[model samples]
Target chain A: MKFIHTSDWHIGRQLHNQSLLEDQRHVLTQIVELAKSNEVDAVVIAGDIYDRSVPPANAVALLDEVVNQLVNELGIKVIMIAGNHDGHERLGFASRQMQQSGLYIIGPLTSHIEPIVLQGKQGGAAFYPLPYAEPATVRHLYDCAASTHEEAMIALLEAVTAHDSQGLPKVVIGHCFLDGGSESESERPLSIGGADKISPSLFKDFDYTALGHLHGPQYKGQEHTRYSGSILKYSFSEQKQKKSVTLVEFDADNKPQISLLPLTAMRDVRIVDGALDELLAAAENDANRDDYLMVRLSDKHAILDAMGKLRSVYPNVLHLERTGLMASNEQLGIRADHIKKGELEMFADFFSQVSGEPLTQAQQQMMVDTIDALHKSEDNQ
Target chain B: MKFIHTSDWHIGRQLHNQSLLEDQRHVLTQIVELAKSNEVDAVVIAGDIYDRSVPPANAVALLDEVVNQLVNELGIKVIMIAGNHDGHERLGFASRQMQQSGLYIIGPLTSHIEPIVLQGKQGGAAFYPLPYAEPATVRHLYDCAASTHEEAMIALLEAVTAHDSQGLPKVVIGHCFLDGGSESESERPLSIGGADKISPSLFKDFDYTALGHLHGPQYKGQEHTRYSGSILKYSFSEQKQKKSVTLVEFDADNKPQISLLPLTAMRDVRIVDGALDELLAAAENDANRDDYLMVRLSDKHAILDAMGKLRSVYPNVLHLERTGLMASNEQLGIRADHIKKGELEMFADFFSQVSGEPLTQAQQQMMVDTIDALHKSEDNQ
Candidate 1:
């Protein structure tokens, strides 16, 4: 059976307060198109269907549209699990009824992990979905002394494997921070430092393990075990990483062949560093104008309305940094004695630094008058 | 065709900082049982499925369980609409796929309201679900001059009737405030004052109109047009209102025979008023001990630890009021001369009134010392 393996959709996520709903819609539409063209039997979404437990209305709508297209329009089966970012109960709501139409949503882990078996021309493959659950819950549920995530995962896998002695060409889907997997800023830390990391060796028995939670498209230990990564670059730290969905095809023997298909964003996130004039010149090129950009200026002085000027040329510029000014100004730090000075003197110093010029005579007089009136009012009170 | 009509579920609602989830669960379970025993063809949930747009996880889970039982287990059809309290897009998510399994959920209103026709042993009945939508949206959607909800309803009904020239038996499900309908504190006002009030004349053509939005189960102008009310008492104002689900059975001619089946709450809300001693004597009977009680004490004197004392007899006392004290205190208002007095003098007056005794000489000295220390601290600042 051939299927599109994807996870970490993180719908309703925002980058620097900018909504990515349109971007999410664009990519999800492409996924639906890819599914239709490839004629995949099923789509496996491992976890993190939403960025938060209670997502905004638009995010919910986008998810509805995509699921409707894939399950109703394309007539393909969808198997999904709740990730750490999701509210397990909320995501799992109405899932039983929904599954009647070929949408399988598994929520919080239970002692009895049911496998959803899918039949193909050659044979049937049983899919074991292990949604993200806390170690304490697992320990209590299984009546075991699993104190860590790895221990909990191992116990769960052993339980499922023991029940499925017939094998039936099994595949496991999970959401975890595997040991040796790369990290990104947007991915919430699963545990303190490396304590929560689980080695990929535990899944050696499975033909293939599709994973989520780490927002980078790469392998942990083996070629068959992979993270499809987030569909979008969720943070500026992920600026250099390529985002993609993993496509896994099963052979006659149930062994898997995996491939990565890159996803093109509606607007790419780019960080450009140069002098103000150089950045403006670069923005003149139409190719750079539309990308969501964070520009760092290296000029040794504060530019007047730098963000406004940059936005005029680069319409999608989200952030602006005066690196050169900050670095130089760090040396000329405010002295404790300066804080003890009168309000007018402090205002004059701040005005000079920001405008790159001394305050005018009229401006200085206005500042003094304002300060005097304020003191007079305070005395009256 | 016969169906159980219910609305204003307001799941996840809280009363006096207490969770009513267990109460809601009990009532919903009873509803499911009623559906099975009655063997209804469909269950129509008019609107206000949740108390808030973004409900807590438990509310979502409860809704999921109830819907699963009604549609999957019992094989009954469910028709729901979005109310003002619900997030329309969120509630309507995956509705298209859900409809495949006989669960029809309508969200925002549109120009064309498609009817879901349910054919019974006798004849076919068309159900036109009119979800809650703003007047502006209806006006823009149909391009009509509808400034009020009544006008919008008229325009929408006209549009539906104009399209449905087949003359099939029809029932309209809606969530709106009709004129002359009694309301409670819990039901959110659809619009300011009388502007939102629509008349029962709009549904004169239909055999029956199942309504929601008002928390009282009553008819407006006609018996065929009615509100089923909420299943639970959401506020003290609704304490006297008897809650019920409206059972509508259609005959061979498709005319609805409506009856109200009273719903029993897990814990009843009660309001009791009398002197404190009289209330304690009444509580000695132990008949209404388990009921959630709001007590109003009529004694003119202040009672120390009244709540604590009352709770011993009435364990579920949620609120306590001293109406006699408030009435008498209004006449003995705060004097302007008291404002000029020292803090210690003001404290003495307050202490005397509450304790019904003057402060001891030692207590007065302590008050003086404390006030002196507070003044010194303020001077230091």
Candidate 2:
């Protein structure tokens, strides 16, 4: 059976406050075209279909159009699951009804994990979907003493193994932060204290493991277990990463062969570094000047209306940085001190910067009370 | 063929700032039970499944639960449409897939109207669902010059008739304001200046018309053309209404028989008019003290903390009005003059009353500019 593994579409995400709907639609169309040309048996979406729980109206429409083309127009089966960013119940609405048309949506963690089996000429593959759930939820659901992401994952894998009675190749689709996977700025923290990290050894028994929640396409330890990465470059930190969907094909012996198919975006997200005058002169001959760009100027002086000047030539320039100014000792000292502050102090500084005022004594006390309450709740869980 | 007709669920609505989700759930459970006991072939919901376009998460979950019970549990077909209150694209998500499970959700005004045919021993009934569309939408869809609700209905009905080629008993499910149907405070006006009113004669060709948007269960002008009313009383103005679902059955001759099944609410909304002291004394013997009550105090003298006192006895007392104070000639004069004021003047007064300050000259200018822009847009439409 040949299937495409994709995740983290983030359909309504914005780039530097600019709407990415148009760019998202362009790339999604390319995905649909690829699905049609590949003539794959099914498409497995790991998780994070939208950037937020309640997406905008146009985002909903875009998803509808894409799914309609995939299921109704192309006659392909689509298996999807909800991630941490999704409203589980909302995403799961009319799921049972949708199953009749070969669209499977797994939302809200349940006691039982059902495997969706797809048969092909070679054989059948049982695909188990483990949607994103908190460590507390995992503990309560399985009635276990698991307190960390690794323990919760171990508990969940045992449940999946209990249901793996069918003698077929198994594929596990999950959304979590796996150990050894590279991180990106756009990926949200799954848990406090960095406890949401699971090892890839738990999935050694499965033929293939498709993962999400990270923005780069990379395998944890083996090529069979990997992250297909996000559908787009969500942040500047991912500028050099090549985004692609993982295609898996199982042989007659149930051994899986993997291939990464690259996707071309409507406009690339790139970083341009040079002096102001030199960068402007380079932009004159730059063919991809319309790409989303972040400019880094190396000049030793301040420039007036630098952003406006760059935007005139490179229309989508989102950010401008002065490496020359940041080379000063005072700026370096501020950056150095940033790493030494506690979480509360860092939050207070962030609050002051955003609100243009210092946190009041009452507000600081309220934050302390909230942190205490959160700790108590975690302890109870 | 037998089917239960219901509409205007307005899920997640609140009464006087109090949540009505519990009451809504109680009534919806009753509707599902009636569907099960009656062994109906299908349930047709005309429109307004939600109170607003973007419903809360709980509201979406409630709808999901009800739909799952009916379609998955009872094996009954559900035909629903989007009204003005629904986000069309959001409500229609997965509709194509849902059709395989006998759940038809019609949203957005398309050029073509498809008939959902359900079979029975006597014959089959082709249900034509005309979801709520603005006058401009109707004109654009059918390429007609429809400027009013009556004209829009005429155009839509003509399109529906063109698709009635199966020679089956035709049933039309629509969401619109008819000419002779009574209106409640909860029913939003379909159009400005009463241009949204359509006559019952438009559906004379159909066998039965299950209408919605009017919260009262009554036939408009003919016995066959009727409204199923809402699942519950949404406003105090509907205090006297007997909320129910309309059951329609077709005989061997393809004729229709209609029956209204009454639904008992968890807590009735009622008005208690009398002196505050007498009302308080009477509450001692009232077994239904928890019922939502609106106290109309007829006391000649000023009462201290009348609302707080009433709430002690009737815990759900939502409103308190001093009828004696309102009987003054000065109050009557103010009320009489309200009708003579212009729209802009009334809006200004309302703004001042709510904000406790008069509109500034600049604000008045902005309002004038907005009104001008609105009028221009309407003219173009």
Q: TM-scores across all candidates?
A: 0.84, 0.89
Model 2 accuracy (lDDT, Cα): 0.85
TM-score of candidate 1 against the unseen true structure: 0.84
Per-residue error for B109 in candidate 1, Å, reads 2.7
Runs in model 2 with CA error above 4 Å?
A300-302, A325-345, A348-381, B300-304, B325-381
Q: What lDDT score is found at residue A84 in candidate 1?
A: 79
lDDT per residue (tens digit) for residues A1-381 in model 1: 888899999999988888899999999988898888877888999899998877777888889889989999888889999987887877787777777788888876767888888865456678899999877779999999998899999989986677663646777999998988888868875543245789999888788898999898998778888899999998767899999888888887778878888899999987888998988877666675887888878888768998988888888888776777774655424543463345666787889889999988888778756865664343222
Candidate 1 chain A lDDT trough over 10 residues, lowest sum: A372-381
**CAPRI quality band, candidate 1:** acceptable
User: Candidates' DockQ values?
Assistant: 0.28, 0.49
Please give, for residues B1-381, the per-residue lDDT of candidate 2 as tens digits: 899999999998888888899999999999999999888889999999988776777888899899999999999899999987777777888798889898999988788888898885456799999999888888999999999989999988886788754777789999999997887867766654457789999988788998889988988778889899998888787999999999989886768888988899999998889998899899999999999887878888987898899998999998777877776758756864665454456678999999999989898778756764664353222
Pairs in clash, predicted candidate 2: none
**For every candidate, C-alpha RMSD to the true structure in Å:** 15.0, 5.0
lDDT of 1 by residue, B79-105 (tens): 999988887877887787777788998
